[model samples]
Target: MFKMADNYSSSKENKEEIDKNLKGNEKKKFEINKYLPYILIILVLVVVIVLFANLSSELNGISNKLNSLSSAKPTTSVTPNSTTENSTILSDPSYNITGSLIVPPKSLPNDPVITANASFGSRLTNINQPLNKSELALFNNANDSYFEEAGQMILNGTFGGYVFGSTVGSNAEVKILDNPFVVNGKPSVIYFGSTTCIFCGENRWAMALALGKFGNFSELYKGYSSFGDHDIPTIYWAPAHYNQSAEDLGNFYSSKYINFISIEDDLPITGGFQLNPMSTIGARINATNNSVYINAFKFILQLNNFQGTPYTIWGKYNVLGADDADFGFKSEPSGNPSIEYKTHNMVFDNISHPNSEFGYLEYAGADLYIAMTCASINNTAPICSLPVIPKLESYEGYN
Candidate 1:
């Protein structure tokens, strides 16, 4: 009976120990359930904060991009080979404003019977006189040899020594057009200018020199630009009674390789620098005209807007303004009609001799114009074989 009581006491102690362990596990489970909702809320807040931060960064990036685009400068968009009908008009305000004028009133008669005169305080004695035998001989003597020498000098890279504040070849204002202006079964060179244009007065020297390389002017005349427009002593390929009539439009230039067409306003400078009305030829030529030369000129003007005087077309290239800026002339107290006349006389005398600075610049400018012509004519001329011609062709994007 003593042994049985000892065994019952040991069993009771074991059951009590088991009950205490179960109560401890139940308390732990209740504590975990009480804080479960708070833990889930913290996790959701962290996810939302992370997502909002990422969205705010993306929005800032987009806003910065938009601001940059809005502040950028606009660029001209042009297609290199676009057809004339579909080509974008590239209008530069600087070019358009250079000696350009609005179309004047049409009330002026087409063939006004106005007398030509040099009444604008010009000092030239022979303002609109035909070249005498001596002057003509001098020009003829200098033509061929000077052109050859200029081309060779350009080829030797020595031409730049005389040029100031400008470069030749690629720096020229010439633009390659989409199609060649052909007339009389040959490529055509056209000039549209005004007698009163100051730039035209300076540019005629280069034009005459370049054209002389290809052909001869039969009836060249000595002329002065408008008295009000600085009375620049110049030569006219046609009989342009400078400061007088506006009817003369034909060029007396003859070339076996190309056709030379000149359309100049024969009128002198009017009051307030107002431009004269268009000449009969300029106003009338259209699609109905049977003359291919006239029609081609009209078409090119339509293709490229007529910007200003001294506008020229050498085969396929268009020069919108004076190719070279005025370099060798003084414009202060020393600049006057008499001085300009003397300077022109000096250039004429030194064309073959080239002993003066003005003579050198004239030839250098002519060399650039010759290079442009060579590019237009596929470098077929004998002068185009010079080393500089090919370089110029590449610079002009011809090759």
Candidate 2:
């Protein structure tokens, strides 16, 4: 009986201890609940601080860029002495200045009279329509397959509807007219592209920037009456690669394309051709040497090696701003393709020698346009006011 009583007393003591432990745990849980809001707030504050630091760095880079741009030299620079000296030189025998060199409106026509109404604007319409239901399903499945193989890429992005291996500029060569042409003692640019090329349109912008160095090439998209419907896009760049959006690219090029004389995809200047301009620019294979496999021909094919809205052209020119990486990068991209041209100097005579089908009268007209672009830009006064696509001056025969 005494032993039983001692056991009972021990059990009571154990119960008391268990009750005390349960109360202590309850108190701890309550205390934790009380401070959870504050702890969560502190975590949020830390995230904000990190984001702010990143934002501040981005702002600093922008500030530096703006400062530099504000300090950039105007496209045209002429000191009083430099102008005076140039005038004196022109009067001398060595520098036979063309009449277009004279400044002011007297030397050339006011603008190009756009006669060809085949505009890029028509392309703007129905450009972004999504595919049919079956097509969309197929596209998604294909894109998922690509990701499963390795990783996701732009080839399987939203814009392209997840079509694997397909790209924005899916073309190879831009054939010129089967005829001879000339520019700065070289061939004209028109001899190199068709109306369908995005690169031809893009190259014109570069040609404009470079020519802006010399003369006042008229702003055409809005200024001219002819390129009324031209709204074709360059390679559709992603938001990462450009400050502007895809809509902005469509709108900007629609409103901003300086309509000189550009061929319409439907209108072949000479031989039959099928190609995208941006692709052609990236590839750097003009029409004259479409069939030739000479070293020079192979050289240009290799030089235009990088892809996706290439920032440079003409061997050493930069189309994008100077801040682009020298080699190239994949940080921000749209339709990135690799291009490599190996040739040094682009000699037209070598590529489009007489007897070549691409060397013809139409080629001469295209050449004239190229010459006009360079002459107008490099000219001190700028006189290329001809229509974007020059007309048949005369198709009389005598080959």
Candidate 3:
């Protein structure tokens, strides 16, 4: 009986030991389940850090490009001032006597009407129009700033590419022959028009701007068209500098590239600004090569029959007006008489308005200048070789 009781006690001790081991295993499983969320969170944090690092690099690249662009833009605006330094006046006697001054007998300060002496009167001419310093300052302050801007835009070829065709102005009807009329061994740009001509008044702005690119103009003076016409404020040929001395022609022409000859055929003769006969003004239009600035005018008439005023002959192309539409068409404003006249007169007055906002026509003028300069046979000036040029596959010459 005692032996049986001892065996029972040992079996009870073995059962208790098995229960303790099972509880310890349950505790180990609970600890592993509790740590699972923390391990997942650490992995997520590592992924977020890598993504943010990549985003930062991309943002930095964009910032660098923006900085480069900011550096390239122009920071200041240019304002044109009419100082003696802006225009170079030659002191040498050789450059002084470009030509004899052509003045109207009535316009000149004289007691009686004077006719040109036979020796002095001809197609080759320049006008001696005296300028009032204060009056000129008013005009210069109104226009010179815009003129400078227009010239730069033409040189840059950024005048909005108004036309892809090589022709300049609306009335490019005539084609110059390839014979290439030369004066003083260089190309000549001949202009035939009148100070009373409103179209010529408007065109002079662009002409001066364009030519100013290649050569300097010293004696250019400000004036206006006839009140009987549109009366637009413009530069008149009266005070323009030209080379008439055959002896000094070669030297002057060599540096200027093209010799510019202009005729202010009619002046404001009466208080009403009536047209009167000026010396050779008629002969100039019908003139042939007479050793005067080459036969550029004759060449123009030869290629295309005489059309009208403001005839510009260059290279092998001739431009009838300043733009394709011919802003200044008639001696007087045309179309819708009531509305057009008022509008036209307003534009004319606005040209000399003290406000800088006026003179949009300068843009058209710049475009014309750019086209003419590109077509010039003697376009060896630095401006002609610019990338902005050569935009025309075929310009005023040849085809």
Candidate of highest TM-score: 1
Candidate 3, superposed: residue stretches over 4 Å from native: 1-107, 110-176, 239-255, 267-290, 293-297, 324-360, 392-399
| Sequence-dependent TM-score of model 1 | 0.60
Tens-place lDDT digits, model 3, residues 182-233: 5454555667666555566566665655565556543444454555554444
Q: Compared to the true structure, candidate 2 yields what TM-score?
A: 0.21
Local distance difference test, per candidate?
0.57, 0.26, 0.44
Better of 1 and 2 by TM-score: 1
> What 10-residue stretch in candidate 1 is worst by lDDT?
93-102
User: How close is each model in CA RMSD to the real structure?
Assistant: 19.8, 23.3, 25.2
Residue-by-residue lDDT tens digits, candidate 1, 1-399:
778788888778878887877887788888889989998999899989998988766764565445334423232322223344333333320010011111222122432323344343454445445666666655443445565565555556664544321222333345555555555456777787877776777777778777776676655666656667676667766556444555445566676666776767666544212345544545544322335434544554354445577788777777767765443545435555332545446656765577655565566666667776777677777767766556655654554
- 10 residues in a row with least lDDT, candidate 3: 245-254
TM, every model: 0.60, 0.21, 0.47
Clashes per candidate (backbone, < 3 Å): 0, 43, 3
What is the lDDT for 166 in model 3?
43
Model 3 vs. true fold: TM: 0.47
For candidate 2, which ten residues in a row score worst on lDDT? Answer: 237-246
User: lDDT winner among the candidates?
Assistant: 1
Q: How many Å off is the CA of 209 in candidate 3?
A: 0.5
Query: Candidate 1 regions off by >4 Å?
Result: 1-121, 137-172, 243-247, 269-274, 277-281, 284-290, 330-344, 396-398
